[model samples]
Target chain A: MTRVHDMGGRYGDGPVRPEPQGVPAFAADWHPRALALTVAAGGLGKWNIDMARHAREALAPRDYNRFAYYEKWIAALADMLVSEGLVSRAELTDGQGAAPGPEGPAAGPVTVQKVRQMIANGAPADRAASAPARFVPGDRVRTRRPAANLFVDGGHTRLPQYAAGAEGRVLRVHGSHVLPDRSAHKLGEGAEPLYAVAFAASALWARPEHPRDEVVLDLWQSYLEAV
Target chain B: MPHDHSDHDHPHALLPPDPALRVKALETILTRKGLIEPAALDEIIDTYQNRIGPQNGAQVVARAWTDPAFRADLLRDATAVVADMGFYGRQGEHIVAVENTPEQHNMVVCTLCSCYPWPLLGIPPGWYKSDAYRARAVREPRRVLSEFGVELPEDTAVRVWDSTAEVRYLVVPMRPAGTEAMDAAALARLVTRDSMIGTGLVTAP
Candidate 1:
């Protein structure tokens, strides 16, 4: 049997204690500018897939430092969401009337789940219905020409410092979607379904490579072209 | 010293949601967004369908426990060998292996996002995606672990890994007592999904 210990008290050695007030207090007008930037850039969900992919790849267990960057970025996004009137202060304070747990008012609202629910229940359809795929399944296609200057989203871009302008067969087709590589407008690759094209190892790298080894890449539809 | 076993059952009691349903819910949400790129989703479905899960990790761990040579290979280069089993791609190309001993414990968390070794461990458990766990695990690992029935002594430094790009980590849990004579298959059965993720340690039946 594992003996459960009360280790909560040990975590308070630093200035990490939860505020005594049931809710975090700040001047109502003290809005986070980073979030306002996201709103100005566009809705938070506009950056969803890129963010998820970043979180999944760059924020693994060993990369604590990078994960901290994501956390800060996400927090900034959240603050922007609230200030933009996309999410109300009351919604964050009281979860549209759900039972409050011991955590506090912000616990329910500030979570990604909460923001997602808000998106589900309310985010406007700026571009939800557009058709973005340039190719169909089974099409022989290749990656479009790489942009001369690399454009990153919020932070440092993780798109291979190499590996752009690669070509592959369109094993399957996805709809039009936002290109991870920021376009001329500087907005995220907007509302589009990305594609997963499988490239043969021999094609991606020249020298000697096993023909059987293949690399499958998830690319926005806009990134592909007819082979 | 004789120990009371009450805590063990309670922690294990918080079973996770059905994987298919959870995936379904997520898929439904993405699909509605018109974001479900069928081709990409198919690859995700295929990768998850064919490989990636606890069963795959258990096989590797069990093989390592029994074979010194395989253990060396796993420790030397997990990503390549795991990819050799056809499980490597963008997220799992880099790998680091951590061993779990009776005295010293280890657990994995992204704290930022769900950076999991999906090629090896299959899909991550639902709790790994929970905001409560994600926020609290790095800040209060021992406490969060105790809630999961993993009690490490204060002296044992529980390294909470924050998985990121360029590196990945997996836990090689210590074999339970009285399991030395057990076959690899039997030992494999003892390897729980949580143990592989470093959320909970495994015990023999």
Candidate 2:
């Protein structure tokens, strides 16, 4: 949905801050734990990564930008854990909630060795190549909104606001990918061919001196149409 | 859009934002329930911070700089080329390396979220996750690049790669001039994480 998180082309936030040479990944002690818990819980295979993303997108638009990256992660992790019955609200508040007690599916008790292997193997989303890609590189195409309403709907979407209508050429056709839109809502992946659509910066904005500059957006088959 | 409007959640803004107490609370609950092991959690964090990071990608870029065959392989099939070099994992299983020449400059941004190639670049830098960068990088890339002190010539066509899928991008920045004599090991030292991210250039030594 068109929330603060989808802040492409929009402005007024601030200048890009220079990241110092060597900053620690986790600022606070909890930051690492927050990231670790989210990844570990997400490893359970209960909800797709897309679904977990909505947990943050579902937050108030104001809160979305205010929370730090890992903070949003922790929020999403907590929301998923509680709503999925992995932990109870009382338990979250009390910090001593009883386990689900073998009633429903548990997400994880991920071992160190398993995480190492998973990190090595990686969670690749590439599915088998499907029907011949409709649009090959050099094919002119336009991105379609498709969704009825972006913000109120509160689901997953890769279509950024900046490049939705702006025309472009397909730079390359990435093989079939798990359609994040459907996967985010618990719908089956129904993998489809994805393409990297390139739109000229001149077309995207009213700026000058960028006739040759372009932005390449990775789009799902459904998000595009032959132009 | 029914949300958790329960009394239990009322202390949200006053409490949920607190990284300290909330994490302690969560650790207490998840550990008591036998979900997460502290050691395993730290291991994942350590891997990204130390073992897997820009140094790995720097090595790849360095090798490509010195070896024409490896460079060709990287451009053709970065996934296999990078994997063959032993850099494969989360946020980086499938990657496409876009080459930047004097005529073309490539930049990377997730736009949707901070979807960086963690296994290659370690954790994403803070600016990468900033609201200003995500919003403007795709819109005014030249301006964004300038903000990062990357002044490109007007003739250079800037290509901003919006990482919308699981397939992450690593910009094979043009090797700086006056480094022809440098070997792969020394060249690796020159590749900063920002250079690979396309936000900064690999300045001459």
Per-candidate DockQ vs. reference? 0.03, 0.54
Residue by residue across A159-203, what tens digits does model 1's lDDT show? Answer: 231235667766443334344334322345455555556555455
| Model 2 TM-score, 2 decimals | 0.93
Task: Give the lDDT of residue B92 in candidate 1.
Answer: 58
The lDDT values for all models are: 0.47, 0.78
Worst 10 residues of 2 chain A by lDDT: A145-154
What is the Cα-based lDDT of residue A81 in candidate 2?
A: 77
Tell me the deviation in Å of residue B110 in model 2: 1.3
Candidate 2 lDDT, tens digit per residue, A1-227?
Answer: 36567877886876888676433355677777777777777666667777777667766666676778877877777777776677777776676756556653265677787788778887788899765689889998888754322322555688887777768899888899988877776667768898988888887788744788888888888888899
Instruction: Evaluate model 1: give its lDDT.
Output: 0.47
Task: Please name the candidate that would achieve the greatest lDDT relative to the true structure.
Answer: 2
TM-score of chain B of 1: 0.75
After superposing candidate 2 on the true structure, give the runs of residues whose Cα lies further than 4 Å from its correct spot.
A22-25, A99-105, A146-152, B1-17
Chain B alone vs. reference chain B, TM-score for every model: 0.75, 0.91
